[model samples]
Target: MLIFKNLGEMASLEYLYKYDMYFAIFQLTFIALLGYIILSWLFRMWKQYKQLKNDKASAELALLKSKIDPHFFFNTLNNLYGLAIKKSDEAPQVILKLSEIMRYTIYEGENETVLLKDEINYLEQYIEVHKIRYKKTVNITFTKVIEEENISVAPLLFIMLLENAFKHGVESLTNNAYINLELIVKKKTLIFSVENNFEVKENAQTGIGIENLKRRLQLIYPKKHELLIHKDTSVYKTQLTIQLK
Candidate 1:
């Protein structure tokens, strides 16, 4: 009878061992499936994140380009209108300059980056257009010290600042108005500043140009740029520094 009980005990132990083995295999399979599901979910999320980032960047770039084009054209047309009304002798020259500006904007402005020299030439042309309009009444001085002419930068980066200087500073002033602009490049960094004198109007509006500029800088340069603006009773100053990649 004792031998029979021992045989039954052994048989029970063997059955338990087989059951544990099956359970272990099932647990391992479940764990592997869970891990695979988690990994697939993570991959999908990462792909979605990348797609959203790309879409946002494209949208911002398009919006920036649109804003720049309209702003520039409106200002230039306004200047042309003034010249046309006066029937000035420089009207033809202004038209030619406008054509050149339009051509530059059409070709180079669409580019993601343009040569610093080309951008400077565009600025010179823009300034020349305004100089003809303001004539000797407003004193405008532009100085550039470029250590590297082959440097490339975003197109129309400085035009807004220059436009603001003219719009708020010299445009409304009756006499003795002045605008000073300087661009300095040193050791992979570009420093630009614009200072102007203006009479404070009671209900003056600082337009959207500065905001647009700030957004563009944030997108393109991220942590590699600095912008400073100072205003007082008589003078308004803007300074921007960009670290080139």
Candidate 2:
């Protein structure tokens, strides 16, 4: 009877030890599983955070570009009205040209990018109107070295610089000031250079348009473009180069 009791006790103790070992393993496994779940949730949250940040950036960029369009449209319309009031006889033809530009500015300008041909045509019409406005005082030349007509570019980019050249370049001309515009496309790069001769007084200020233009460029192209402005003696020069992807 004693021997039987001792064997029974030893067996019970051994069973307890095995049960304890199993319980310890279960606890460790539960802890490890919980830690894995927590780490997985954190990783998912990080991904979501990055995605939201990118979305917000994209939204902000779209809003900024939207703001720029209205400012540009308002300015162009004001200029057109001034021309119409001054030159009533040519107002009809000017209205036609203005309509084309308005169509493009309203519809196409809202897009992220536009066909290069459309931009070229829009600029041509704008220059034609300017020619009518300042016929005798302003001399304008446009040169292009593009091999293809189906290229795409960011909208209203070059026009901003062109408009600035007209606004600030010719106001100080004594005889006849000239604006030379050039566009060159080679491989994957598009280059624009505008040179204007002007008389500079002591105090000269570049207005909101230029600043707004710079902001637009930064938002759209980021690191894909370069803009250079130089004033030497009596001439002002602006050069812009952008890589088209």
Which of the numbered candidates is closest to the native, going by highest lDDT?
1
Per TM-score, the best of the predicted structures is: 1
Candidate 1: count of backbone clashes, pairs at least 3 residues apart or interchain: 0
lDDT of 2 at 145: 98
> How many Å off is the CA of 183 in candidate 2?
0.9
Off by over 4 Å in 1: 1-26, 69-75, 78-89
Tens-digit lDDT string for candidate 1 (1-245): 89989999999999999999999999999999999999999999999999999789878876886676355567778878888999978889989998988898778877889999998889899888878766558788889999876899998899889989988888768999999999999999999999999999988987888898999898888999999999999999999999998
Clashing pairs in 1: none
Off by over 4 Å in 2: 1-89
TM-score of each: 0.83, 0.75
Q: How does candidate 2 fare on TM-score?
A: 0.75
Candidate 2: the clashing residue pairs are: none
- For model 2, give the 10-residue run with minimal summed lDDT: 64-73
RMSD in angstroms between candidate 1 and the native structure over all alpha carbons? 3.1
